[model samples]
Target: MVTPGSPRGIDVKIGIVDYEAGNLKSVETALRYLHADYFISSDPSVLKKGDKIIFPGVGEARSAMRILSERGLDQFIKDFFKSGKPLLGICLGCQIVLKSSEENSTYCLGLVPGVSREFSVEMGLKIPHMGWNQVSIKGSHYIFRDIPDNGSFYFVHSFYPELDKSSQVIGSTEYGIEFSSAFSVDNLVALQFHPEKSGPFGLKILDNFIKGAD
Candidate 1:
């Protein structure tokens, strides 16, 4: 039997928040391949067993915020972050974790002091900024640990985080302009790229996350 308040003797239970987001299946698939035990749930009680949380999204900002509010998950996430558990937010999930988003002027979780803005169409770059791009590791982050200093990850979004505190930006990539590609602030970490679709390099990142599930 496992000791209470110590490391639980079970497969790492990862909670994938089902908040009407996108690319959740790929997240699950990556975790499964890492031999992690996880479940997708909107219920806070069900998520109580999870050692870590993954909030991935592929949807409009306003609608996504509305859905999270309707499900009472907006506050849930805020409170959960206080517990100091490892929380990973991807793409739209990354946006909503900030104070506000330019996308429809949506207010988000305020977990990070930042704003999400869209890439200017006049910049002669792709609108969505989709496909693999090199991510320059600016500093040490738990998720990026043990990965190549220079690596590429899959990205598929137009909006990117503009952090109020530049120190939180641990990873960055160039598109039309250099934007905050990833952030790590204590227990909360968010990435604009899709590590699930990033192949071996991506998998290695996920593997590091799994190992850090303690």
Candidate 2:
């Protein structure tokens, strides 16, 4: 376990899964700022050893799933979640963790019971929905420990998760329509926003995950 307030998470190792989908530098920078001990890798063998995992990405769904499958990370991630360890997902990572995506009709990890759907063009909003948006907290979770209700977080995506009624929707955002912005299931927590780039509150979210998540 990582001691709280330690400069380098004294005993914790966080693995940032790199499946050739997203830019990892921002996530790395945030972890470094939190004084976390982490490594970025695509190897399942290496990632499996981490005390916690961060799965973040930005890209088209089908292509991203293809890369994960090609590198055998698809199954590895599923197994990791089944191990009941702390796992965090962001953006595309959050989308692909669902059952499938409307983006090119891609099949996803199914860790969460949902499907990713593209925002309707008729919504009259921007395509990517890029920028800081407010996330209304819907329930309690370690990741939201220090975050205020309706705190704004950075988001960049064209698709959003349409979770099952049985799924826990912990955060919701409105962009012409109300959509799930965050969800938690057992040891897994995912967000549609980018906490790393959302400034102080965002950092707080990451901090909570690193130091407070069980």
Against the true structure, whose lDDT is highest?
Answer: 2
Q: Count clashes in each candidate, considering only residues at least 3 apart in sequence or on different chains.
A: 1, 0
User: What is candidate 2's lDDT per residue for 98-134, written digit by digit as tens?
Assistant: 9999999999999988999999989798899999999
Poorly placed runs, candidate 2 (over 4 Å): 1-10
What does the lDDT read for residue 146 in candidate 2? 67
lDDT of each: 0.85, 0.88
RMSD of each: 4.9, 2.9
